[model samples]
Target: MTDPAKAARRARHDAIRAQVADEETEAAEAEAAENAATLDVSLHLRISHTLDAELRRRAAAEHIPTSALVRKLLAQAVRQHDACGLTAADVEEIARRVTREELHRSA
Candidate 1:
């Protein structure tokens, strides 16, 4: 009940679609691999138990890993021009302000 030429054309179209999808998936995986390769740096640090608990609490509150929270804070610190001039109190103030800002922004 179907025309042979029409059936053949449909088959070809389906095959082409499948091939394109496969190629796209392959390209995406390759791009992810390349990105992961570039971001493969590790850092380790030792801090007081108090700081560790605080970091874990903040990370949990933000629904991110502790490492991610630390990275975000460090990134913000790195961007500050007066970071070298910061005292302990100044650092605490900055951390509080950043935490508030992050919460407000996410809200």
Candidate 2:
């Protein structure tokens, strides 16, 4: 047997929480819209289960979607690669050198 006054107060509290959540979502969307260029062209990738799980876990921890986390990582990677002027060829050569050095050390 709950008091009517208590029930009303609980309802009001729930409604206020919902409203605040909605406002936060709207604010995030607006900020993303302003920061994005060309409204974000879609780039799809087939990720492994391990990567997918990691992305979901990290995104959940950050309170953002998995897609958003991936986008952030991709943007950072692109910026760093561009600044360093690193190409696919450079990456391949570096990998080869590292592998050869490791094999030589093991021998």
Candidate 3:
């Protein structure tokens, strides 16, 4: 028979492992969907080293792939541009707010 304390600890570990596995499976499915939807969507962008570093850092902090982060940012940019022809200042402000919100959610 399992010892009570060990049994409780094992239960917690098992629960966490199961949850992580479920999350991983969901993420994989979502990624597959994202890939299947992109057709001739190849984009090559050149940016300053600083920007690249920041993007990599932010993506890591959010626990998402850099390509996924870039896709999300591009989608937001397109929507904002179409909605109002957003100026540089408007885009910058919106980006800052969005970054904060994303980081807060991750936290």
Best by TM-score: 3
Instruction: Write model 2 residue lDDT over 1-107, tens digit each, in one string.
Output: 47998999999999999997986696578558745754667787798999999999997777676777787898799998889977899999999999999999999
lDDT of 1 at 81: 55
Candidate 3: C-alpha lDDT: 0.85
Report the C-alpha displacement of residue 89, candidate 2, in angstroms. Answer: 21
Which digits, one per residue and each the tens of the lDDT, describe model 3 over residues 14-104?
A: 9999997887786677667888898647889799999999999988676666788888898999998888876899999999999999999
Q: What is the C-alpha RMSD of each candidate to the true structure, in Å?
A: 15.5, 7.5, 15.8
| Residue 57 CA displacement from its true place in model 2, Å | 1.9
Query: What TM-score goes with each of the models?
Result: 0.41, 0.52, 0.59
Scored by lDDT, the top model is: 3
Candidate 1, residue 13: lDDT: 100
Tell me which residue pairs clash in candidate 2. Answer: none
lDDT of each: 0.80, 0.83, 0.85
Clash count (model 2, backbone only): 0
Worst 10 residues of 2 by lDDT: 30-39
Model 3 worst lDDT window (10 residues): 23-32
- Model 1 TM-score is 0.41
- Report the Cα lDDT for residue 106, model 2: 100
Sorted by lDDT (best first), the order is: 3, 2, 1
